[model samples]
Target chain A: MIDLLEHYAVAIMAILLGVVLAMFLVLIFFAILNRLWHNRGISRKREASESIQPLIYSYLDGSINRSDFAARLKNKHDITATWESIEIMIDNLSGEERKKLQMLLDLPPIKKHFLRKLNSRKPISLAQACVYFSKKTLTDKSIAVRLSVLQEHSYNVIAYAATLALVNTTNQGFRDMALLRFLLRKNNASMAVSDIIFKYYDISDDKEVAAEKLEFFVMNPDIPDKTRAAVIRMFPELGFYQTADTLRDLLQINVKNDPTGELTAALLGVLIDFSDQKLREIVEKHRLWESPSREVRLKVPGVYADIYGEETTRILLGLAHDPELEVRMAAQRQLLKHRPLISESRFEPDISTEWRAMKKSGDADVSNG
Target chain B: MSQKVLIIDDDPAVSNFIKYRLSKKSYQVKHVDNGIEGLDAIRDFEPDLVILDMMMPGVDGREVAEQVREHGLIDPNRIIVLSGKKMTDEIKALFDIGIHDYIQKPFSIDLLLLRIERALASLKSR
Candidate 1:
């Protein structure tokens, strides 16, 4: 029995060793193949770029006509390279040159090439095709339908790219459907979601219509608090000041009821940009400085300062004593800026010492000037 | 003699396109990729106008502009900045340092050409 067990153990060890050896060899083989593939790709891209650039420039300068340029760009191996070159030109050039390039993208061969890529099973190829389409204003309903399907792709990147492409379409129904799907996606990274929403606004021909669509998302209670907050935050930057009144009302409501504090904080942040006497009254009525949410209270100093200007000295001084470190720091930093208006004698001893120390450290001077 | 224009931009696509356009327009153009090389080109090439890209890897356009202004390598008014950055206080400060003009990127090439012509014409007048 002992001899039989020993033989079995030795056989198992040999098999395990063979498996490990096979894996190592496979790894080595793949590494070499990957390096060769990468080098070849780089060389091919370089050659394509060198050959295609002059043709593009010539086309731009009117030396080559559109048909001739499209014909030259038809090299199957260099299609990606040609598209990339055209993409760069489309991004950088405007006026007649840009129009010509945009028209070139619709030429039969180029459109067919991208259309074929759109049907690719590979995620990277599909995503690239989607991105290429996003840069163009699509009139093709069939392409939009393909993009609509891809927007639901399990891969988040391909889905996001497809959604962006759909948003670029002139079809309002397609654009709305794509955006609604994108906003409803639970797995989206916050920054990517923000960017896509911004892109939706960017590509919209009618700013007012876009604002109304954004307002719907902002006002919809079923939409995630994060998305609403992002939309609210973008309003000031996008110059949707007309939404300010609605935002103020939302802030009042959220101040009373928002559980997460994120939405309330975002409202406060945007309102600071559009702050006025009415916003100031709202701030005072809520006494937002003493809000239960620390995030909301943190925004109080900026809103107070903007609405009250030099008169914010007292509130800044009061907030300088807040329980939260960040809130106190924010208030103190603002206080330092208003140092000229502050009466040092009114400061309590501990606060006085801290203020003097902050001054001596050059923080005050930096803020004051 | 044709006017000399030096382009300091990292993007070959942009620099090459500009070079081709300017060369066709009869301007002697030289292209360099980064700020350090750009500074050297400023001295070596002594271009009548410098088309500088604001953002680059090492030694950015602002520093190059500052050095040129400090050393009087070229007239501060001869520098035109190409930036994708929106107009901010920082960009406004570039004008205070005497940059000739700021053209936002994704800019019309024709608009850029027009600006270049006007800048050079104004220089000739001065």
Candidate 2:
């Protein structure tokens, strides 16, 4: 029985060693293959850069006409190189040069090449095609339809790229549908979302229509608070001060109910940019300076300073004694930054002492530096 | 003698395009891919006008411009910045260092040629 067990153990050990040796040899083979493929790619890129780039430059400079340039791009290699050159030129050149390049995209071979890429099963290839289409002005209904179908792709990146491509189209319905699909996606309230919306807003010919669409998103309670806050922040940046009253109303309703303070802070932050006497009255009525959320209170001093200017000294003096260090520091900084419209005689003795101490520390830091 | 212009942009597409265009206009043009070579070319090539790109991998256009001004290798006004950045405080500060002009990227080749002509003309006048 002992001899039989030893023989079985030795046989197992031999098989394991053979398997390991096979794997090692396979890895070496792959490494060599990979290096050869890498070298080939590098050489091809070099050849393209050297040979095709000059022909493109010539065509652009009008030394050689379009047909002559097209005739030179005979093989798959030449076409690929020309495509690469076109991508670089399109990105870095604009005005008349960009128009010339855009005309190049309409060429049958180039258009067909990219259209085939759009139908590719590879996610990267499909995404690249979507981005390329996004850059060009599209009149093809079939391309838009393909993009719309790709918008539902299982891969998030491909779907997002497809959505962006659809948004670039001139069709309002397509743009609205794509944006809605994007915004309604679960947990999609991100900076990228804000950027896409901003781009959509920027491209809209009718500013009013775009603003109304944004306001719809802001007012919709179904939208997540973070997403709403992002949309609200866009208003002031985009010069949509017309939404000031609506934002103030939202703040009034949500301030007491807001647990995270994000919505309140966003509303306060934007309203500060549109600061006025009416805003001050609303802020004072809401008692936002004493709000439980430190983030909301932090914006209060700036709001007060903008509306009250030097007269903010009194309020800032009161705030400088607040429980939160950040709030106190914010109020103190405001006091030092602007001279009071009110005279020094009006300051309470303790408040005056606190102001003097803050000023001394600020000066000491500056001089020390 | 043709006036010499040195291009210090990292993008070969941009630099090559400018070189081809400028060579057509009979200006002696040379391009370097980074700031260190740019500074060396500024000294050795001694081009009359330098077309500097603002953003680069190491020692950016601003630093190169600052070094040039600091070393007094060339007149700060002989440098024109080609940037993709909008008119911000930083770009404004570049002008404070006395670069000749700032052209935003995605610029028309024609506009660039025009600006190059004007910059060279201004340098000649001075």
Candidate 3:
């Protein structure tokens, strides 16, 4: 037993010694690696700035065009550091100087540099490329290729950056418009594009032009699905001049394509949020569940209680027996959510005999459709 | 006797660009990179117009503009505040202080130059 105790202590000490040794090696290795990285970063930055300063100063003096200034990158040391310094300058200026910097980004050499980095298999490289594309609101076909690759990449940051780059580069400063159309219509990929618009883009620009452009793009079918839905979700934030008639027209147009109830609910919610007398009357009289999309049919019950009194509760009551389980469940959920709002004195449409007559008159067909 | 325009901004690039541009228009421009120094320049340069920035590390543009106006160091109407940090209330407050005009940063130099001429002209009329 004493011999076993001695052996166990030896075993414990061996394990402890191994852990301590491993930790010491790891600490030393990382310390050396960090110092090397730091030194290399400093020297690389120095080299990049040293090579570019003369050209930049000359450009400032109006002695050189942007193409000639950007062309100097061909002889660069540490392209990353060089790009970083140029990016800082771009961010620092505004008006014509900033516009000139943006033009430089589109120069063939710089574009080639970015395009090459955009195709790199690593996620960080892709992210950086996306960021550069966003800076000038650049729209390029080659960058689109990188976006496609990034769409399938496993990294979340790269995926997000790629989408924003696509939106920024292609959306033509109508991110609010594009995001709303695609965001609500497709009901996916909303958060990333929304974040980019709210975070990066200046919202204080000309609202009239933005509104007109937003209206045009939202009405453009060729735009991607997610982008259109994003635009739909972005309506309130766009702060455009909205009439109930426009919302009504928008609903009529949007309902045609809605494959699910989500769009109907969203459009109706928009109608409720931006309430209008004519729109409310239209909602009160119209059979909302007449939408072909089951998703739209499911949304009718949820929105019905807001438009009319308990007499119109028959609409939901009729929908309770919908053939699609999804629609019936949706009705049940709406009934519970809106139970408090139900009027104690039901409307003419709520009478038992009137309900029965309505039930027999193809009301189910309206919900099913 | 070129009209003196004192530019108060922390960004050297912006201030230098404005100074070089305004010099071509025959406005003698003096630039200081922060608010405290700007206050001193407002008193010393006796500028016909002062281009101020809203934000800085110490002695912000608002405070400097307020002090310049309140203490009678410069005509409040000769002060033109430039800021990217825009707020309607802040702009109204500057206007209430009788500052000359406001320009958002990243502004057009031509527009800024024109505004300065108008501001200085208004001062001359006064």
| Candidate achieving the largest DockQ | 2
Q: Show model 1 residue runs off by greater than 4 Å.
A: A1-41, A187-194, A256-260, A291-295, A306-312, A322-329, A336-341, A355-364, A367-369, B70-72
Per-residue lDDT of candidate 1, residues A1-369 (tens digit): 999999999999999999999999999999999999999988888888888888888988889898887777646656776688777777777778888778777777777888989999999889889988987788899999999899889999998889888998888878888988877766676676777888889878888999989887778777777777876787876888888888887877777788778888998888788864577777778777878889988998887564334347667766877899889878877776677766777768887887777666546457566
Residue B11 displacement in candidate 1 (angstroms): 2.0
| Per-model TM-score of chain B | 0.97, 0.97, 0.95
Root-mean-square deviation (CA) per prediction: 4.8, 4.0, 13.0
Q: Rank the candidates by TM-score, best first.
A: 1, 2, 3
For A1-369, candidate 2 gives per-residue lDDT tens digits of 999999999999999999999999999999999999999988977886688788878878888877887777665667667777777777678887888777776777777778989999999889888877766777788899999888778777777777777877898878888877766565554675767777689778888998888887777777778878877887876899888888888888888888878888899889888874476776777787777888888888878765455446666777888899999988877776764454566677887777778878867766886
Clash count in backbone of candidate 2: 1
Predicted candidate 2 versus true structure: per-residue lDDT over B1-126, tens digit per residue: 999999999988778989999999999999999999999999999999999999999989999999999999999999999887565887988998999999888789998999999989978987
Give candidate 2's TM-score: 0.83
Candidate 2 off by > 4 Å = A1-27, A74-85, A149-160, A186-191, A231-238, A241-250, A253-258, A274-277, A292-295, A309-311, A318-330, A340-353, A364-369
Summed backbone clashes in each candidate are 0, 1, 20
In model 2, the clashing pairs are A310-A341
Query: On DockQ, who's better, 2 or 3?
Result: 2
Better of 1 and 3 by TM-score: 1
